[model samples]
Target: MILSIKNKTLAAITLLSVISVSVFADDNQLTAQEKADGWQLLFDGTDMSQWRSFKQPTVNEKWQIEDGAITLTAGGGGDLISKKTYKNFELTLDWKIAEAGNSGILILADEKGKYIYSHAPEIQILDNERHPDNKLDTHLSGSLYDLIASPIASHKKAGQWNSTKIRLENSALTVWQNDVQTAKVTIGSDEWNSLIAKSKFASWPDFAAAKEGHLGLQDHGDKVWFKNIKIKELN
Candidate 1:
């Protein structure tokens, strides 16, 4: 077909647009890698159906859904807990700490948010220089709570977003901040056994056994926000 230069240009642009959208369509969907591994979105920017308060059963307190993300509207009173319990999985989430200094916990194997089962440990969040726990464990922002503080310092400025990841296997646990490995521990291993023998949890049943459990975000009475929280179960 004979076409004017303007028409030719328009057609070319249209074709390019089509190609771009086609690429986007494929890219927008879950990638083959993600699909093959079967990862699901726990929060998609507008709901908290997948989460609840550790202290509340049917009602979610202070945890708000906004901008396609899950966030803590206010800190304190209670913590956010994953609606679905998990075991032997990898977890990833984004978080930010607000002013006034607060803390949160990535706790696992919690029984109704009471305490960490043998399988549950915490990746504590705090304002290193300004928070009390920071003194207890200067690795503060990314520490394995009291059990094992962050191997190194890692705390972003308040109000800035930070990414965190945790992996829990049959007996091994690893934690990452941004992209650096900050903590690693093996449950029931010699180290764990040694600690358990003298620690408070030593008497608890299933203290280090691989089992089903929930993910908990501790309430430290300050403003702490979280988003992009997801978990992938490992066979």
Candidate 2:
């Protein structure tokens, strides 16, 4: 009787362990409800079939899949661009940076440009507490890089995941960080040009010139991880 009881307890513990692992294995997948809502996984956390190096024919090997996240090895990969261009859409992703790391998400990225930054407007990603770039409001996490500052500083510490959402529709752009709305702006308006004139991108004629282009992830020579990358197109 004692042996049977011990065996039953061991089996229950083993079953619970398997259940927990199964839950974690589904972290980067979209549920049936998400598919019905028009959501699509951009990363899927296992491969880069949806992305490629900017202007290159292949996905850069430096961007690797590890533990269900797309991780960038410092100084190993060039910027990555989505294979499909989006004119208006909603993007959601989770990112974690190493101490003092830096990166960005570029929207409307013109693939033919010499560099992604020269043509796309960026959603800044940095270690706000440790990166020197954090000193400037427009360069901090969740900002419309160098153009608009996040009204609320809501970045998590380095090594912790930060949830971000960017929505663009009919020329209006909104950014959310950690579930909090952080910035809103209208593209191509007088106010938009005014802000651009004050930023480092002022001299780049190609900057923000396109209404439709690929999305890009920066290769800023810092270790960064991105997961749960998904998007939905808007009419």
Candidate 3:
């Protein structure tokens, strides 16, 4: 009886190990627990049906779903925006950049604006070690572009996937890179306005004026890959 019990216990452990591996291998998929928590997959590792081009009618051809990621190579497609606008939410995604690549994730971006950067705030993404933009703290990876610098530099090297999370609730914005909190800022506040005044967006009339708008992925003429994009609305 003891021998039989030992064999059964081993089998159960092996089964659990397999299950864990399977769950981790699947990219851009929401698990049962995530679904129950109201998490939504923005990119399902298959298509760009949930996204469209800024000011354009359709998703640009330069943005392609390749190797289970929304990839942009030889960039010229312009920025990509979510079809639905979000007010307050938590977003998570994985991104990898080519050598010296430059890109960014924009929040509260206006689709009708002349440029996403002019109307929204950006979470800078760059090859921190290789890109010249890294010279300034505000332009480094995971920084709140030109407004606030990341408290810590936690970006993985080029060609390696890095996890990023952005949370916006009650006008407070927080950014995380590789599970580390990189920046925190409050929107539409006096401090925010002061930062904007000092930045290049000082003359942009609609800069950071939208309380709710589409999320955007910048196309800076460099190769970049994004995947496992997901979001959960916050009350």
TM-scores, one per candidate: 0.76, 0.87, 0.92
Ranking by lDDT: 3, 2, 1
Instruction: Judge candidate 2 at residue 174 and give its lDDT.
Output: 93
lDDT of 3 by residue, 31-58 (tens): 7667888999999998899999888889
lDDT of 2: 0.88
Residue 170 C-alpha lDDT in model 1: 83
Q: Can you list the residue pairs that collide in candidate 3?
A: none
| Model 3 per-residue lDDT at 206 | 84
* Model 3 ranges with Cα > 4 A deviation: 1-6, 18-25
lDDT of 2 by residue, 65-100 (tens): 889888897566999999999998999999998999
Q: For residue 209, give model 3's deviation from the true position in Å.
A: 1.2
2 or 3, which is superior by lDDT? 3
Ten-residue segment with the worst summed lDDT in candidate 3? Answer: 17-26
Regions of model 1 farther than 4 Å from truth:
1-32, 112-119, 196-210
Tens digit of lDDT per residue, candidate 1, span 1-235? 5568889999999999887764432311333455567666666666667777664674355666555445567655476668887778888778878765666555555653254333456677766667665666633778765566665546677778788988888868888887878878787689877766765556666654545677777666676777777667898
Number of the predicted model whose lDDT against the real structure is largest: 3
